[model samples]
Target: MILLLLLLLPAPALSAPGRTRATIPGDVPVVVEANHLLRKGEGTLVASGAVLVTRGNDTLRAHQAWYDPRSGELRAEGGETEARVMARVDEGEGPLAIEAGQVTRLGSGRLRASGAVHLTRGQDTLQAHEAEYDPASGEVQAWGGESRARVTARLAGETPLTVEAGRVTRVAAGVVRAFEGVVVTSDEETLRAEQAEYDPQGGELTATGAVTLEAPQGRVQGERVVYNLRTRVIAGGEVAAAVPAPDPEADVTYHLRGQSIRGAWKGEPGSGLPQEIVLERGRFTTCESPRPHFSVDAREIVLRPGQRVVGKGVGVSLFGTRLLTLPRIAVDLSGEKDAPGLFPRLSLGQPDTVGLRSDWRGTLPLGGAASGYAVLSARHLFRIGAGIDRFGSVPFGLRAGYKEEASSRFVSGLTLTVLPAFTFYLPAAWSPDGPLQVGLERMPPSARLYSGDIEGERWAPGRRYRLIASGCAGRFSEHPTEVTANRLSFSGALEVRPFGVLPRVQVGGALRGRVGYYSTGTRYGVVSPELSLYWEPSRRDRLRLDWRHQIARGTTPFFFDRIDAERSLVLEWRNRTPRRALALKAELDADNGGLYAWEIGYSRRLECLQPGIVLSQRGGDFGIGFTLEIPGLSTGF
Candidate 1:
């Protein structure tokens, strides 16, 4: 009961194993008994018996007890039995067993237990003849055992991140401050220090006084360190670090003995490899001798971890001989990628037969999360007819776009494009073969377009229902003809998600009403309804099928344009998680006279670039194309 009361109090969820062996209802009546009972008349109630208190997953037992509620004091005495006074508290992973010959509680939070006092939580154990505890602050102090105080804890992770210390303090919930001869260890790493403090919740650790951390990648010894567990960012002073080459076969560890080091490391999440790092006021070398055969004394050195070693204000020595000097240089440590700079693209028949296009792309982060992003790209296709006289912009020019979303509820986007199209003809002098083809030419002019959209979605009462409203507007203009037009469209949709109707299956359907109007006074109304079903065929494969039907009504001349109702069924399937991902999509029963189209694509992701192949068929046209994703900010080669 005492253990349950302590857990029920505001504290971290350190419950042992989360199982209630035997429980007593809190609202039930309580009966106290003993061979002899006495009341001090005004203050204390004393009883003697084989006492037992139980609540939920916690229990306390003793041979005798006394309580002074007005003074907020409780005491329990143990007789010469096999089990003395003890309290067992269960936390999800295991039970904490605390015992003492005599136990005393002051107020609601303070406790003093003496005579062979011991505490055990999970695999960790602490022993002391005397101990004091403050439950509100999770502070514990102990002395006795004819020796000194000590603490040990098991850290659960990919490896065993356990620690042992001469003395430990719960500085605060989720935080532990330990002193005197502390040793932290894991399967692949170990850190020995004189003192250390750590926050288990944040995975942050700080240590001081002759600290040395060793792992598979390298080793570091320093006077102090502040390391973030999640980000793998570390800052240490009076530091000596050994960074290994990305390739193990190199059999060389680069040593950076420096005054300080700061960097955000990159490994496979928790692999403990420093993918990136930086050091200040250091001497770096590849030699493993007691004294480096040669080293570079630098003001700063940045490790593009595994990729390159960049240095500034660097001086090199060959066996203590001042051999060379470099103001700045970046040594290549890794190979190249389809980079972010200008890349020459070759297409078989895009804008023309065997066309060459120059493409440049870049991406930048606007802020936090995945939504605030701005991407810019420019591409120019080089095509030829003979005797080109006019100097004009190339085909498919430039685009700048940005998008942001507030989670899944609201989204906003804007994009501007420089779209180019031209028809070419040979001049009289250029058409040497025939005069009939001299004047045959068609020019459609150039155009630019801008578009924006805003959307908001909300759930109605139950999670199965959703309401969405969105609006979009766009404008385009022809340069030479000065012909301009604008369009605006708004839609409202109600979605029904009855996903769990079948096990391991998800299904949804929605009805949408849309209205679109153009600046030229042309208007269209659409009644579109869609139904979709998705199933997980395997642990790593998914298939989705959808049926979409649209009813469109508008006025138009048959000779100018024909407005037809459209209905289509689409199906898509993909692998859930793979080194290389593949997807297939098919559309059936479409608007342009009952035709079907589909596409299949495969993609492979690299650190700097992703390459893809797409095979698509639309109506009667089929195409197979190769593409490269070079749209992100470079991680500096």
Candidate 2:
């Protein structure tokens, strides 16, 4: 049977003495082990069990092996043997190894490892005390001690990816450079670097010197920092810094120092969306007074996500007083409230006898309601007078006034008279809700009279009630017998709010009648009755009381059957006190045949000083007067 099947087939494969076995070139059958054979020069190989090596798609395994075909050294050792090394340039499932002690093949496609160096790819795990590998540019370089170089990456559903560096460098393919204290964690941001560079094929992350960029919308301090995980951009450089959320009345403390700073993370996905800062050469100030009310300067500045600052060279001040100089300035973390305006004034005073007096007032904004108000005025009453010296014959007088209210419903009016004459007011219409009035007159036919009047008022349906009326007619052209005198006056009033729990209390009464017919017999008749009382407790207190009564009957020539009766009483008061303390005005008059008069006044305020008093008894000649007031020389309107 062919020599007994060649003695059971297995005894002719043993060559030991100057040992040699080498055949590693492809298709899975590789074995390289030698004892001493110096094939081309010198050699040493000692392989004990299971040592296999393949080339093209690289596979290497060993138990105990040593080979030196004259320094193309390959060494592997194992007490618990397990080594598998493979390479296919580097993608998934390539370039991996386990339990490597010493393997040296240095010829440009370098590879060198000292003691325990384990490297794996595809679920990546790299541990090294020392390793330097380059299988034709699929680089790996690591250093150890102080917690010996460790790298781990699991990726895909992400949780493992970690790196700690004391020193690590793989400069080219898929670049990485870390030194000193560098740490990179990957479950969405945790990086600290004294120097870090990682470019997993340009999915970029670069950091320099003292850089720190923590995530969760917060810290970024830098000398250099750049991160771009596929265009999710973040950049920083210089002494670039950022701090948001700390305002104690913020007088310049919303920080972002910059030579450069750029950040963006918009919309959807965990919605903490708060990074949209773009600043370069920017500055901001909130002004807590030692001379700053507002400040901002920018070549560029745009910060969103509620710290909302959009700026470009803007400056504003108040208290440190410099009102607005802006190129552009916008700040609204959305708490909107703004109030400004009212720093205009001019005045000079001496309010009675009207000598050396000047007044001008201003306040505006009626329709847009910033408290809805309007007022403007001009007054120069230097010597307003009335004089009469009976038998010795002399007469004198003067008056001037100009007032304007440009929009609490329009009024620009003027009144001027000299010697009981001249009067003028062409524009009229005043409104506390439309109470229209008009008047015109001209008289000089030796002081007779010619007149015109129109008035209106309507507030009947709960506008607190009002119905007042007036119609006057006059024509008296000097009658020395061509006799002319036609006068008519009609009036009505009923405006009552008698104290329905006193909303400033007001009581009113008025009835007036007048008629005259003369062709020389001088026929005339008059009846006047008036009573008024009003009290406003606040809005700067005011009180008033007035009573008037007059009855007249006439014929002509030193009285043929003429009788006259007059009675009057008037009292008024006004008050305002506290810083702008002004309580000015007093007038008391009583007449019926008793004749009494009293006048007291004060006007200067704002560091107040005032005194004024006057008492007069006309028929028997009695008088008293005193006046002195200085409110820092009063000037305001």
Candidate 3:
């Protein structure tokens, strides 16, 4: 509602063709101009042909206007063939303008505008079918739904705001209210509520009664929500939220129910993504079922959206049954598919090999690009040991530490990239059994003739070939014998995909050969040639088969590097959907003419959690294990 204080002072009427002016007595004189002004019946006046009324810095233009001196009533309208009536007022920062089909000032000091009414003040604007303003009460009300035109208001800034509803009212300066299916959109967030009010002075919008806010990052619903437009902060009560897939490439959505929640976003100024959020007395789950299979409850939870979530006084539940409780728990939003099994990581070991073994592993950052990892394991009953290794990479240089499980030897190696496709490594090992002895383990230089992504299933027509060759000379302390053994070895592999077309179904082959000579008067040479066929039936499915034959003459002194099978056939299949995946692999021994080893794995994804199982069999040994992992925080059980 706009207040137009029109106080007219009577002036001599004119019927000439030229323009005439009538003035109003005021601090800022009000002037009325018309091409023709005529005295109507009694004290009534009529102004026609380009009627213009100006008061101070404000001006109104219309085709015709009628005024009654006694009633102090005025009416203005656009001609049948002319544009709508328009008015503009300067308000310091910018101009305020209004346009309507017809406008009237009632005897009771009420202003009404009908038919395609539009009002704009500075960066804010409103549009409706009709509007009414009462100057005495400083209230303006707009209605639109009846004519199939909903009232819309726009508040523009860096993060622009637009609201549309059935009705809108301005009760005071900088305060606006809306009702009935009100929707407010600010940048990427869209909010809907039964009723809402906004205060431009404070940059606050309060929504009540079934409030819901949705954005690209997630969805939030509550009974009431107060959002700070400028700061992009949200505070709400009794909220339920669904954070779908941390990003667009994910398939999971985490559902959270909380008594109260507060969130703040950090990104592009108007991205509407909450990077930090706090929820009180809440429970969350990745399960989509109404009755969740698993959930975590916590007294307080803090979330760093798309990164991790931390909870205090946490309880984990499965099928409405409490499984465990802890003082605190934190999980990453990115989940891993395959990880070591539950607490005290257990692997089903063959009795003839290592029997049952349990291991605990941890990693620590050693600063810069270096990290240290440790593994403690207990095998059978007599063997218990811990091994630590530090690995780092600087540009093209590599540093690594490793442990030989069988002989309890610690090995450290440094590799330097001599060229883009060539590297040299020097390795040394120290034995901790009996008397400590350190010796040079090996020196290896490797070169890759060519490297390519031949299995990417894309049509890049060319003959793709990859070849890598390396040679090593080393002195190792062989167990059970005190004598030192000197060894020289060479290994190389050459793979070539001769055809570039038919990328979805490609054929490849590789020739791999190794030769070793020991000062202990033992020599071994082996060569393996393999033919592999790969097929990708669709984006979600892949199949590959490999037939390999090895020609062997002698055995190596090291048991760990000895070849167990000479001829084998391997087949692998992989299938994936948005939320589920399956993988299977099998190998057959051609010499024994029977199945050698096989494995099957399946997993389902839910947000940041992926729990899976693997079943495998080799020879007479069978094994099964469960795995859970979080990729973002890199933790698993």
Which candidate has the top score in lDDT?
A: 3
The lDDT of model 2 is 0.44
TM-score of each: 0.42, 0.26, 0.62
lDDT of 1 by residue, 1-637 (tens): 1110121221122223422122212343223344455677875767666555443455556787776757656687797774577765554434556687988767664777778776665444555567666655555665543565455556454333666676655532545666778888756777889988877667778989999888776788899977766666778998988877665643446778888998874455856655677889887766555565466778998876455676778887645776668675454454233222222333332212233333222222342111011222222222211111132321111222211111110111111222221222122121224422221121111111112221222332334454544444444343222444564556566667546567768888888776766678887777778888988878668899888888878742111112222677888997623235578998776655453567787766453244567676654445455554322211111
Backbone clashes in candidate 2 total 1
Candidate numbers sorted by lDDT from highest down: 3, 1, 2
Report the lDDT tens digits of candidate 3 across residue range 1-637.
3322122222323435668777755455556788877776785778878788766666677898887767766788888976677766454334556688888867775668888888876556788898877656666788884767898888765557888988888764657798988999987889999999987777889999999989886888999988887776778889988776665544567677789988774444667654677889998776656777777789998877665677889897766788769777666464442222122233333321223333322333573221112233233233332223333321121212122133111111111111112122223222334432322222111011111111212212332554444454555443333334666666666556534348688788878887878877888888889898889989889899999898887866654335547888999998866656688999887887777678898877655556666677765556565545322332232
Error of 2 at 537 (Å): 55
**Candidate 2 ranges with C-alpha deviation above 4 Å:** 1-30, 33-38, 44-72, 75-110, 113-120, 123-139, 142-194, 197-206, 210-221, 224-238, 241-255, 258-269, 272-304, 307-331, 334-409, 412-637
- How high is the CA lDDT of each candidate model? 0.54, 0.44, 0.62
- Best-to-worst ranking by TM-score: 3, 1, 2
Candidate 2, residues 346-432: lDDT per residue as tens digits?
222221212222221112223111011111323432322211112111111112122110111011111222222222222222226
Quick one: best TM-score, which candidate?
A: 3
